[model samples]
Target: MITCKDFLSELNEYLDEDCRDEVRKELEEHLDECPNCWVICNTTQKTIEIYRGMDPIPIPVGVHDRLLDALRMKSQIAPPA
Candidate 1:
């Protein structure tokens, strides 16, 4: 059985369809048994679908910089050099 941690670790690859068949099967099984993970996966998939259908809009530089700064602060990560 795949743990939530394992599911999360492979999430990006799974979403990208880059995981092996065996791993994909395990992830599917995990999603079936885990409601929370299922919600997360479903929401993310839908979000991606919605975004993919949209036209790209450029953000204003100030807003973009503030967004990045906020994300960095939230993650407690240092800014890139």
Candidate 2:
């Protein structure tokens, strides 16, 4: 059986339905016996479902530009000596 840590590491791939069948079986088996992991996985799946159902709201152009500018400025900053 896979450990909780293993499940978490593959959580994103499993959630995305990008995992192989063998991996999926192992993850599902873990979820079956572990209540904590099951809750987390179930909740995450539900959240993803609702999130995907909603229409995406675009951020303002100004906000986008400022965010990009901040990233660029931060990247260009020299590390402290």
On lDDT, the candidate that comes out on top is 1
lDDT of 2 by residue, 11-73 (tens): 888898678988999999999999999999999999999989999789999999888778778
Misplaced by over 4 Å in model 1 are: 56-81
Worst 10 residues of 2 by lDDT: 72-81
Return the top candidate by TM-score: 2
lDDT of 1 by residue, 22-63 (tens): 888999999999998899899999998898889878899999
Q: TM-score for all predictions?
A: 0.63, 0.65
Enumerate clash totals for all models, in the order shown. 0, 0
lDDT of each: 0.90, 0.89
